[model samples]
Target: MTPTLQAFVLVSGALFSIGLLAALSRRHAIFILIGIELMLAAANLNFIAFWHFAPQPHQPTGVMFAIFSIAISAAEAAIGLAMVIAVYRHYHTTNVDQLDQLKG
Candidate 1:
């Protein structure tokens, strides 16, 4: 049987919670980036779920938004990763706390 709206919402909530926890608790820049990506995925999941349940799914607005979000997320990931790499090269560590010690 197909999953219900509540099920999708619950899963999305779980994903968001996990992402939030990871993002807040992690000390590595890469881990934080991963957590942010997870959070974005959760948002995308919600968009898809709502779109599937909408009365006018044929309108495609929700789908378009989701696609745009995915594109944005990809760009975000690229920029975040590049920053992480630059920080790592300069600091010789990926730890978030150590990043503050970077000097010009």
Candidate 2:
């Protein structure tokens, strides 16, 4: 059976919800980053879904947005991971709650 826009939106919403929960509840830097990435993915899915369902199928705006988002998210993820690695190297921990001071 073919899926509808509502189905895609529902799935996207679910992914966003999970991502939010992970970002808010997790103390580990890596987990939080993962949550953020999940949220980005949901957004990308939304862009594509709307684009696919749009009346003007000739336009590539939605796909373009999704692609740009992916590229930006990848760059952000790399930077975030680099920051996490630096933090770990400095503090010897990746737990957000454990990080209280900003000093080296």
Candidate 3:
């Protein structure tokens, strides 16, 4: 069955909520990054859903935007992971709550 915009919105909202919850509740740096990624995916889902439902004259605007966003997200993931690794090496802990001091 074909899904409606409302359905897509609901799903996206749910995904965003879960992501927000994970980001806020998790103490590990990796989990926080995963939550951020989930939020991004929700945004991408919204973009695609809108593009599919809305009329556009032979334009790939939504797809392009989603692709661009994916690229940005990839870069973000890489940078985030690198930072996590660096922090782990320096502080020997991945728990964000434990990382109180910024100065090394």
Worst 10 residues of 3 by lDDT: 51-60
- The stretch of ten residues in a row with the least summed lDDT in candidate 1 is 95-104
Cα RMSDs of all predictions?
1.4, 1.0, 1.2
**How well does candidate 2 match the true structure in TM-score terms?**
0.95
Q: After superposition, how far is residue 70 of candidate 2 from its true place, in Å?
A: 0.4
The sequence of per-residue lDDT tens digits that candidate 2 reaches over residues 24-103 is 99999999999999999999999999999999647899999999999999999999999999999999999999999978
State the lDDT at 54 in candidate 3.
Answer: 83
What TM-score do all the candidates reach, one by one? 0.92, 0.95, 0.94
Q: Which prediction has more favorable TM-score, 1 or 2? A: 2
Error of 3 at 16 (Å): 0.6
Candidate 1 lDDT by residue in tens digits, 1-101: 99899999999999999999889999988889899999999999999998899886378877899999999999999999999898878778999987675
**Backbone clash tally (model 1):** 0
By summed lDDT, the worst window of 10 consecutive residues in model 2 runs over 52-61
Candidate with the greatest lDDT versus the true structure? 2
The CA-based lDDT of model 3 is what?
0.96
